[model samples]
Target: MGGEHSPHVPERVPSDDDPADDLPDGLLVADRDGRVVVFNSAARRMTGIAASAALGRDFRDVLPLHDAEGRDWWKCLSPYEGLTIRTRHPERSLFLADGHELLVTAGYRRDAEGRVERFSVCLRDAAHRARQERDRADLVSTVAHELRSPLTSVKGFTATLLAKWTRFNDDQKRVMLETVNADADRVTRLITELLDVSRIEAGRLEMHRQVVDLAGEARKVIAGRVAAGDPEDRFRFEARGELPEMWLDPDKVDQILGNLVENAVRHGAGTVTIVVEPDAHKEGAAVTVRDEGEGIPPEAAQRVFRQFWRGPGGNRRGGTGLGLYIVKGLVEAHGGAITVRRGPEGGAEFRFTVPAGAPDYAS
Candidate 1:
């Protein structure tokens, strides 16, 4: 008699036709018209609504839902077919009537002819993913924060000593100043390389290129260094024929020359030479810097330009390991290519070619 009077019997306890009936979370199904056609036991439990009461009502009217941005999820979902939705907005936390939180995903279904006929949305809580992101961000922030003060101190002390070099005895001044300067340079290189890598990854690298004299700039870099071990200064210039003027970025050319010369000075104990030749193998201007010191090991020759990479004995001296990377970036940005090889006499050589076309220096 109670059943006859009530008309409130639940759908026959999830027969094979309603596989979603036993799901742990809510399941919903609505027709294209947006009328509630199927509400599982889990959904009833989530929304605290009896199936009989929700059967024919509009899905939105029965249990309202909003997206992450506080927009009406039902309205957005109504027109689209087979789309999933996720929300992470602060104000619109995904909470059920029973005060439980859930991460929701909803998709639609269409008939064989490709007409959207029904849609279903299901949700599972996503408290874990949110926590992981927070932890990762915290770690990067902490590393950056801890590196600040020590780096600043190193740079500051080095500057102070350099500024007051005349006040100290020659022997004491040389030792202190060199050590301080080296450490400061090391720190500066690390910070700069880190920032550049970040910028490159973010696709924000901007190049300021202009017409430049490659031969003159190459000479300047060569003249600045004193030959450490070689009987004569390693810096040499060989013009195969007549050097051609090419349109390129002056700053980038300087950077390229400086990086190559510095690399030669660091690895080669002897002489480093800069040679300019008209491209015989290809059509372009070719510049080569060869060092007479111990050549790069066969295994390491190819990887010389990789980011944060170090060659044999590269560790004895301090470096950010970014010089070659920057060189490569700047060269490529100028529409040129750079290469490394072993010279005939026995040492490492780097050659790069700039194409004949005028580079848009403002990029």
Candidate 2:
């Protein structure tokens, strides 16, 4: 019987001039009979339904709510006060009559008799939030899949070595031990990337800014890579002109160069080159890392810096694809810009600049 009654059943209701109308959050109040009584300005803007059309309309009929899966969500509402639901459900979505979607949460108010006198629903545009959630889930799933392979290898090798310790020769044991260690290192690198991502997202990436010898730092990175047996002949370091000491974070510089060089050696074909030169336009110096591998396509140059953005051939090289993204962030944090273009050798060349003077890090 209550569902059949018209929305005008409530004789006294709050007018449009009520303070609730000025609230930022959308507020839709329905009477005990489930009729819309307080359709505020914010609610009208959120649902695109005028107060004149919604005020006397049944709440269920006027607010065509739906879940993320497009199932009717109005059924979740209850008329009794004690039976009301109030909480922010991130997975819930509200579908407007015009096909727009909104994220919604609901609450209810009760009279002295303990009966549900009014219901309120708050609404927000869900496009951005929903996209963020979906991206986060994708990242988690990708990272899990990446972690599983090395874990399997580590487990399998260690188990085999333990069981066959007495049966295998010293050389065989050493080879298996090296394989296990490589897998462990792979796992560690993935975990470190994950932590770096977390820090970047939280805006807590620490940068210790001081005058750094750019040429010296680049040489050290190249030396480290060579020492690690990453094709010593494949890497070449060159300085175009006299480079000066710049105010930069040395550790960040190492990370940037290391990621770029490692990426080059892993994906590029013949050679990887690191060049440092004085920036004519700015007082700082510019560094370029080039690889003779398959250069990035024109369309992919911009997207290469995005998190987890791997090209079509990315599968060939086992990488987390977070290197460029971290490099971009660290470079920008030092008040610099980075760009990618076709190298003179017909390969991918990544060029970034470091400011001569330190940026206002306090901000």
Residue runs of model 1 more than 4 Å from their true location after superposition? 1-182, 226-232, 359-363
Model 2 CA deviation exceeding 4 Å by range = 1-92, 95-98, 104-125, 230-233, 241-245, 359-363
Model 2: worst 10 consecutive residues (lDDT sum): 81-90
Per-prediction TM-score to the true structure, in the order listed: 0.53, 0.68
Q: Per-residue lDDT of 42-92 in model 2, one digit per residue for the tens? A: 788877788777776678887887666666777654445334344233435
For residues 90-191, write the lDDT of model 1, one tens digit per residue.
232465544556666666576666655765667554555577577568646644653564577677667767788677787876776677666667566667
For candidate 1, give the lDDT. 0.67
How does residue 354 of candidate 1 score in lDDT? 81
